[model samples]
Target: MLVKSIEKRVQELNGNLELSLDDIFYTVCQEYNLNAVVIEEALGCKCPFALIGFITTLKSADPGNYIQYKY
Candidate 1:
């Protein structure tokens, strides 16, 4: 799953990725090649804020250290 893959990548990166919200949104959208609406529905969130919250909840990293999709 994407979430699991992201977790694994983050772990491999060793620590936080430190990216802007726009970078995150764009990366996810491009990676999945999904529209914003579809992304929101898939994540069970109505908006970007909620989506971020949902993603954060699924990962083991702290808020400050999450969203780090690196090797």
Candidate 2:
């Protein structure tokens, strides 16, 4: 549900340059009825880190947003 809300917000804000990262994050949280902590836990990060990762994911589906692998 949260993911869906995030997706929807992303779609809605995609063409709007006025919406800052904070605006997008807040909007997504509001749409999904989730708190920042929930998102942080889901993303396995803390405040700001989770936000960064979410932003990264929104901009591009980069695997780096999820996890990093070193080999």
Judged by TM-score, which candidate is best? Answer: 2
What residue pairs are clashing in model 1? none
Question: Which ranges of candidate 1 are over 4 A from the true structure?
Answer: 6-18, 37-71
> Judged by lDDT against the true structure, how good is candidate 1?
0.49
Deviating ranges (above 4 Å) for candidate 2: 37-71
TM-score of 2: 0.44
lDDT of 2 by residue, 1-71 (tens): 44454565666765588976666666665554446555566666443325544654554454343332334
Output the TM-score of candidate 1: 0.34
- Cα deviation of 19, candidate 1, in Å: 4.0
RMSD of 1: 10.5
> lDDT of each structure?
0.49, 0.54
- Per-model TM-score on C-alpha atoms: 0.34, 0.44
Report residue 18 deviation for candidate 2 (angstroms). Answer: 0.8
- For model 2 the local lDDT of residue 61 reads 57
lDDT for 49 (candidate 1): 46
How much is the lDDT of residue 58 in candidate 2?
Answer: 50
